[model samples]
Target: MSETTAEKIPVTVLTGYLGAGKTTLLNRILSENHGKKYAVIVNEFGEIGIDNDLIIGADEEVFEMNNGCICCTVRGDLVRILDGLMKRKGKFDAIIVETTGLADPAPVAQTFFVDEDVQNNARLDAVVTVADAKWLSDRLKDAPEAKNQIAFADVIVLNKTDLVTPPELAEVEGRIRAINPYAKLHRTQRCQVALSDVLERGAFDLDRILELEPEFLAADEHDHDHEHCHDENCTHEHHHHDHDHHHDHDHGHGHGMKHYHDEDMQSLSLHSDKPLDPNKFMPWLQQLVATEGQKILRSKGILAFSGDDDRYVFQGVHMMLEGDHQRAWKEGEPRQSRLVFIGRELPEQTIRDGFERCIAA
Candidate 1:
């Protein structure tokens, strides 16, 4: 017997309101004197790439091109772009997706769990929301997207702290605690926080999620009317799922009742007692990423492939992909493979069929 093949990959999503210094922060990270290499993807990246050029010399390893805006245009395409990047995975140490300020975090987070191509390659590091300390107090209350961004963030940066007073910062921090009390908060002047503090936070803990969304967990045990339906065998309960683990809390906070959703995102897990062929798995995953990518915000899992000693652990956010052979299985452990798909209103049977078709004998 051997252990299951699955590893968590870290992908940091950089989000904020317009002119909240997201690009500036990205530039600072890329230009850091550190030896690590990073792959970057941005909507209107060509325009932003120009800025990077102004700051540093050309390097293709830093990809800043657009298939479309990640939130809407290239919602499912992120995994494809990630697959291409993996062709040269050794050239970069990590991936950073800089999303448009006005976008919703749900769709972005959904990408990591739904796309097979991504689930085969990478893991979600964390969702980092960079907020303007002065403006966010108002934005969180008024903007729906702002609330969602905060709700999904693993790390929140109260940027531009220099411009605000200590009392104002304290007030903003209080509001954040009300919405998402679990996410780690960092005070930064112009988004200058240390990279180590933001990435791989894994702050969205199961205990916290259950506390915030027990209804979602309960819905699985007892049938309830839901906007989205999953397969009969599939349930969206977090704690009951094998993939559920005790992880750190991540996600932003601070919106009013208007920001709270009647429906939390849905998650469906597919477990196979057997191995899957990579050739069949790839196309089905790419198709899934292309078709329902927006609805399928995030997809991740560990896969056991036939005739392979090493297991594949993967993560996907929209079209972005990051995955690797995490490690060889340990002695006397079961080699079961499992995947978790989370999205807004996913059709469970559809996902199950797609996965079933990819099974190897």
Candidate 2:
């Protein structure tokens, strides 16, 4: 459905590992002149709803889930809270669920799917992940939560890119790519990406699934040489921004990076040039997730099934998978099936063999 649909309020789940700059990006989103009202539901450690007080409005609500929203227990609270929020829906334009840096985003996302009330009123707009460029590589080596955050992201804000060297930056980006090649990757400093790139993206909207390949968006980088603001202390009485400090070196850094792979967390991408048999593909996909969901972190696809004219779209978090016939194939659209999975200890050969079996003869 289109984002303009009045039926469902869009929700953006913001997640990241500790010290990944999620709050910074969130503040940028709220601080900017977007002319949109957002209802923010935040759960931070230490019960400090400091950010909530900073936001202004009758529509803006903040209920702290003191314990991290890591599992199904918190999911219940989320569902109830969302159900209550729906009653006052018309007051706010969109909702932002900001999970703690350490919290898993799966349960938060699942709320929209599992709850009938939430599903009827709110849509999962996107999972926007913020990553720390200087330390993500190290975190990936030791932290599974960090890997999951990166894997589940629809839009990834690669924040603090200026903190790392060119090689380190590329290494981090390559590491992120290894896990999720379909996310819209944007590089930023102090989480300064354009609000448009993050909020109300319609990232999860079926009609917006134009491409599966990751987009390299040079966000927060529009060449405007006018009205330079260099002093860090300047409070922007005149909203001037040069942002040119990193422009020269940042322009030429994407191609030379070495591909760094996480041994446990890897993405498996499968594509078929021919149409797939829906009857076979659907059952196999369900069975695959049923047995291996624990190992899988995220899954998404756009499919071309035999005897079907519309492009089929699907998205999954662990075992919970959802798909629908989006739109009819355009005149020159290529009929192809593309699937991606980010998970731990993936049964790659088994998956490949299984998918091959689903191709139409």
Candidate 3:
């Protein structure tokens, strides 16, 4: 089954806040001589490639661009548009969904994993986020969707380098790094990044994540900046510690940069040197997400089971989880398990206690 992946088309999700150069980067992709065919799905008409064009389907808002790429407006639902595109699949090499600037990427990404028909025909390649370096800092403070976009990104294009000073640029990058250190970061002007960097990144593919390792931020001792959101998902009756206070635990960053701690949204990383009992671990994880998935925006694990030679990996979006045995552990490699959860007001103690119980006795 090594060649099983080739049968599906790769879908790259483009996301960011308003005026983040998503359209510019997208136009670059459409105009570049990559010698590949693309079927683009935009949220509304006249947002992308609206120049002297041909109307292939008026009611459907599907048309052909001057560059020979097929473009369509997302009139009603995304699944319907994808279903229509699937019929003409062979004509294109890949699918790129440029979500509206105000859109949340979770539902868009969830389509590839939750729908069996979409899953069979397409595989998620990556979530590419275009950020306006000049204003990302401000958005990070005001917008929940902005933070989620940064946390969920696999590739981040920090564009408009020409707009700010060196100090301003570093602060913006630091803010982005605080949320997600794993995404590939590229600083560009006018969204002039190499095409190879964004397309076909395979960020969600199991093979691409073969060695799943993450860098984490720890609780900082000095910062005082904090903000909280009383999300309904965070207000659960957990039989544990005080849930009334803000969960603002800031991690120290470089150069005396103020560590901006998001009270409502944050990431937690758990690790175990000891092998986990699969019977116990699997059920605990499923139950954890089943009850808390609405709060959990994303979850992933690279596990080393107690009695198995092969490693297991899983990726989740809300309530959906997909996992499989990846490959045998190398002779000299350390056998350990690492799990990460990024979400809003997660039940840390419940998750920690449950994870601790999964360790093999």
Candidate 4:
């Protein structure tokens, strides 16, 4: 990557279900004096009603197909809007895209990966989802978009905790973890959180995973006491612990133990000690994504390819995948491969078997 592309503008996608405090979070982001200029792209102008120097209203005309997929239609409009933003180069340091309450984040996210121009000018920093603490459990059951928003999040702000008790907050958090174990969760009232927690997160950057979540590949941390309370009047029977994974990043945040289970949307993590045959792995991965794109919301991997000195890093949103040879393996560092997939009803065994077959002899 050239220095020009290396310094590509970071784009943050903000999404949530209806009445989930998205606008409140947007206002907070805009109002914060972080000494950075942001070019905001919002679904509707009047809805947010916020004054900013570089705010653009999106038409939100992208329609979903019969299968309820929105990526096909929104790609063109997003490309056009993003291209226009590139013209005003020095006006902003980063971009924030706020989707509608009912929007499916797949198409919005796919835009950053699928388009050549957009890819050159921008990189997806993270998908920050603001979810209503009191209503999220119900929304998860009644609204598919709600599930998608939570599943796609790199940072989830469970807002409006004042509306619910501590036990209820724990329940909502549990539901969220069941869907996406990888996302960093924050409990807040009125969408209030430290600005450092959400911006420049490097969520989509494959190399930054170690920096973001140091325990991502650690095996001992895998045994989390997963539990959840589905009933409204339920007691706090779930096991909770304070587990802090320190990062070199400035934001000092600790993650709590998370546990929950949802049949529709879930996350799968895979690891391999052996180097993989790229030729075999690539073809198998392509076929898997092609056949199960809709079910596969987000896929990321850092692989030890056979006969390669550099680490092979790849990530995908839906069917679109992008990868490259990242930094070289350090001397004596373990060269195991790690992969995590967050989506709906993934065929875990089939994927594991295919990945195992890709192991080099």
Off by over 4 Å in 4: 1-6, 63-73, 215-259
Q: Using TM-score, give the best candidate's number.
A: 4
Residue-level error in angstroms, candidate 2, position 17 = 1.6
TM-score of 1: 0.51
Model 4, 293-313: lDDT tens digits are 879998888889999999888
- Model 4 / residue 272 / CA error / Å: 1.0
Better of 3 and 4 by TM-score: 4
lDDT of each: 0.60, 0.71, 0.71, 0.77
The residue-by-residue lDDT of candidate 1 on 1-361, one tens digit each, is: 2332644345688888887788878877787777877777777555453333222222122222255635433245566667777676566777788788887665555556555567566766678888888988798767867766665566778789888876677566655533443345688897888887876555332222323222222232211112112333333233222111111111112211112221434456677767888888878877887777766655666778888777677655555445677667668755656676555566767888888888898
Q: Which regions of candidate 1 fall more than 4 Å away from where they truly are?
A: 1-9, 46-74, 202-361
Per-residue CA lDDT of candidate 2, range 116-230, in tens? Answer: 6777778999999999999998998888788889988988988898899877887787677667655777888998888888887777676676643333111222221111233
Model 4 earns a TM-score of 0.84
Prediction 3 global C-alpha lDDT: 0.71
Lowest lDDT 10-residue stretch of candidate 2:
234-243
